[model samples]
Target: MAVTLRPEIAALPPYRQGRAADAAAFKLSSNENPRPTHPAILAAIAESHLNRYPEGAATALRTRLAERAGVSIDEVHVGAGSSSILYQLVQAAAGPGDEVVYAWRSFEAYPLMVTVAGATSVQVPNLPGGHHDLDAMAAAITDRTRVVVVCTPNNPTSTSVTAAQFSAFMAKVPATVLVILDEAYYEFDVDPQRVDGLTEIANYPNLVVLRTFSKAFGLAGLRVGWVVGASYILDAARSAAIPLAVTEPAQRSALTALDIETELLAGVDELIERRARVFAGLTAAGWTVPEPHGNFVWFAAGDQTSAVAEVLEEDGIIGRVFAGEGIRISIGEEGSVDPLLGSAARVVQTLPKAGENARLG
Candidate 1:
């Protein structure tokens, strides 16, 4: 007989990573930084001693981040990735019968993490234009709600919540509920009006901000991320984290990445420019894309998702597809721009409804 598993766990599908591309294709499926890894980070990684376990606490990195964010050392916690911290936070705050609320189609990992922690997921539907309806999310919270996640420049959709919207939402939320602001793509957002989690974290005692080195720092392979919040809440997350999951190489690399951040952020500026071009190109092609604040664009193809994905793949552009939902194409190398736009234009012409559904309500 098969080993018995919790029915919910048994029924859940394993997480699917972005499709790998062949030599000719641009891998825009995972919103990775297209730039080459910086020499400094590589040198730092090379210096790691494999025989020793990583410093379990990642104290040095935490200290640096705390100083940078103007928080106490205990206020910051590091994990394998922001995703890992997310799972830890979920497990720390919620359990069976409790609810973890977030906007639908925000981060694919949110529901999975909630389920793994035995908590119910409360997904608030996004408003038209792929943005979170913060008011609705606030209203969804009940006495059973333990945590609420807000993903800015939300993954896949590439839309953001403004400062005013967030401030208003926070006002409506109860002080007892935990609010996690997932800002994994923070560096790519150029909007002056976008909510800056670090700047806002101090105001809310229950708020925690998550960020990662994966996107703008060109450190996706390193798998290091951090959070800034009240020491007690972060202490709970720490209690839930797997021991020594942050490797020495990852920690050292992140420290080096921080050292040369100015140089790294210059690359982020280029990606921002490329994002603008891709957004403009898609719009010109008659696909109504949400104004992208992340380093990617969303094609809300709805039922045409698979067909549009096929066309993109035929043109050597591999993007993440959510079957009937939509396709999320990351802004990649400069060379990918023309081919991506060409494929998008073809989809608009051949699949008229795809273009129509791409528009927000």
Candidate 2:
């Protein structure tokens, strides 16, 4: 007989990643920085000592992140990736019978992590404009709510929560409940009114902000990320983390990325420009996409998502598609712009409802 497993765990689907493209196709499915990794970062990774185990506490890197974030060393925690940090924090703050709240159609990993922690998930659906309904999320919180995740420039949508809206949302949250602001795309955000987690952290004792080198730093392959929060809360996450999961090479690469952040940010500036181009191009083509503050654009294709995605694939453009919901196309290489726009225009011509006149459910 098969070994018995928890019914919830058994029924849960494995996390699905963005589709990968073959040769001749632009892999715009994942929101990866299309820019090549900096030479300095590559050199730093090459210098890592493979003979010994990595520092379990990730002291050197944590020190660098803490200093940069203006937090005490104890308040900064590093993990394999920001997703890993999220998992650690979720497991640390919640367990069976507790509720972990976040916006629906947000990060795909949020529910999985909550389930893995044996906690209940409370997902408030996004508004028609693809922004979080902060008031509803706050209202969903109960005495059993142990954690609330706020993802800015939410994955798959690229819509952000403004600073004013976030402040109002925080006012309704109980002081005892932990709040995690997942800012994996923080470096790519261009909106002046967007929620600034680094600055907001000081106002809320229960708040933690998560960021990753995976996007703007072009270090997705290195898999390094960090969180800033109260020392004791971060200590709890650190306690649950897999020891030394932040490998030496990843640590070295992150340190070097920080050192050359000026150059990396210059590259990010280019992607930001590309994002603007993508937005304008899509809009002019009759597609109604939300103003993308992150590195990707969202197409609310509704029932036409798969058909539209197939059209993109035919034109050598591969974007992340959510069946019956929408498509998220990342801002990729300069060469991808024309094909992406071409495919999008075709979709608009063939299905007008997926464009400017579309009604979102």
Candidate 3:
């Protein structure tokens, strides 16, 4: 007989990753940085000692990050990825009979992680403009709620929450509940008005800000991420984490990436410029693209999502497709711009109801 598994986990679908593209196509499905790993990061990785296990606390990296973030070392927690830390936080704080609230279609992993921790997920639908309805989210929180996630420049949508909006939302939330701000694409955000968690973190006793080295630093393969929050709250996440899961190479790379942030950030500036061009191109072509603040753009293709994705694929422009909802195309290599624009134009011209369907306006 088959061994029994928890009913929730048994019934849940496994996580689906973005589709990989062939040689001739642009892999814009994962929102990965198109540039190669910086030379300094590679050199740092080469210097790692493989014979021994990594530092469980990632002390050196944490020290560097704490110094930069203006937080105490004890207040910082590093994990294999931001997603890993997210899981640790959920498992640490929520369980059966507890509810974890977040915006729907924000991060695909939110629901999965909550279920694995034996917590119920309460997903608030995104506003029509593809932004979070912070007021709605605040109202969704009940006494049963333990954790609430706020993903700025939310994944698959690329829309952000303003600092004022977040401040107002926070005012409505109880200090007893934990708020996790997942800023996976923080580096790409150029909005001066957006919430800077590092600057605002000091005000909240129950808030934890999650950031990743994956998108900006080109460390997706290494899987290093960190959190800044109350020491006690982070201690709980640490308790839930697997020991030494963060490898030596990852720590070294993150440290080196920090050291050479200026150089890496220059590449980010270029991606921002590319994003502007793509946004303008799609708008000119009569598609209503949201103002993307992340390293990707969203097309709210609705029922035409699959058809639009097919058009993009045929043009060798592969994007992350959410059938019946939308498509998210990452800002990829410089050469991908024209092909993506061309494909988007084709979708608008060929499909009826394209204007109404291409945006959740």
Candidate 4:
């Protein structure tokens, strides 16, 4: 006899992560905020109990998040990270034999998470401009569809579908299907129009908005994220969540971080500027990069993405290479980006002065 795991689980692709370690690594594979956590948050977490059980209800953190999010405390649900709660959302909201639709190349996690819940995934292909094709996504939905994920400023692509488009899609889509808007990199932008979809959730009962402290708050290691929804939907997630999934220190840190939102957003301003600088820098360097509203940049360099990444990795600056599809590089702290920029300059300088035939890898 032999032991075997679920075929779908065994067949699932591994979750891709940003490289965050190395002596000289400015490893920006993960879309992490380069800024360190707020000192107040650090102090609060340190002062909190190490052995006590975290509030299973996550009441205080929920209250703070609700105040900041302009929603009721009951409308908020905290998790170890938005990613974790999203996993729970899929399981609780969707089921086997159901289909989950999302944009291909959106968040790499959507498909895997959907499959883990025993649902099939339908990833609508990206539009020509690298944005999610909401029209196609909405049309792809069928009665069997249970949830649809919309990752704005979509993960590897670093592009977003506009609010108008999202509104149109939301209008036509059946209210029975849950629409999860995963805004993992929400705080690092100045584009009011594109990211303003947060408030739009109020109108749709099926809306589930996901956010995290991992980006602007620099709390990736702490893993604090939450869901904003109608009290009914959030209550469902609350009841379904693994008991006390959030740690006390992480919740305390998230609360302290919320109190200093202004300072944190100010740092976000600098990060946005640096992202623009890097975008301009790449464009001036004669590359075909996309306009990104997130904290990172991606370009369609064909096979050269791997080449650029290899040269960067050799220089001890690890970047994410999508192989033939393209490459994504993140904007971190000033000191962090300096080394990355240096390596990038060399990778660009040494490559063939022409097409994607040049292999820097």
In order, candidate lDDTs are: 0.93, 0.91, 0.92, 0.79
In model 4, the runs with Cα more than 4 Å from the true position are 336-339, 345-361
Sort the predicted structures by lDDT, highest score first. Answer: 1, 3, 2, 4
- What does candidate 2's lDDT look like per residue over 1-361, in tens digits? 9999999999999998788999899999999999887889879878989998998888999999989989899999999999999999999999999999999889889999999999999999999868898999999999999999999989989999889999999999999999999999988888889999999999999999999999999988878989999999998998999888999999999988888889999999999999999889888887777889899998888877888888889999999988888888999999999999998899888877666433442
- Write down the lDDT that model 1 would get: 0.93
Model 3: per-residue lDDT, tens digit, 117-213? 9999999999887899899999999999999999997998999988999999999999999999999998899999999899889988888999999
TM-score of each: 0.99, 0.98, 0.98, 0.93
Number of the top lDDT candidate: 1
Clashing pairs in 4: 18-29, 18-30, 307-361
* Shift in Å, residue 115, candidate 4: 0.9
Give per-residue lDDT, candidate 3, residue 249.
98
Count clashing residue pairs per candidate.
0, 0, 0, 3
Per-residue lDDT over 145-253 for candidate 4, one digit per residue giving the tens place of the 0 to 100 score:
9899998878877787667778988998999999999888877655666745468877888998999988888888989898898888777777768888889998888
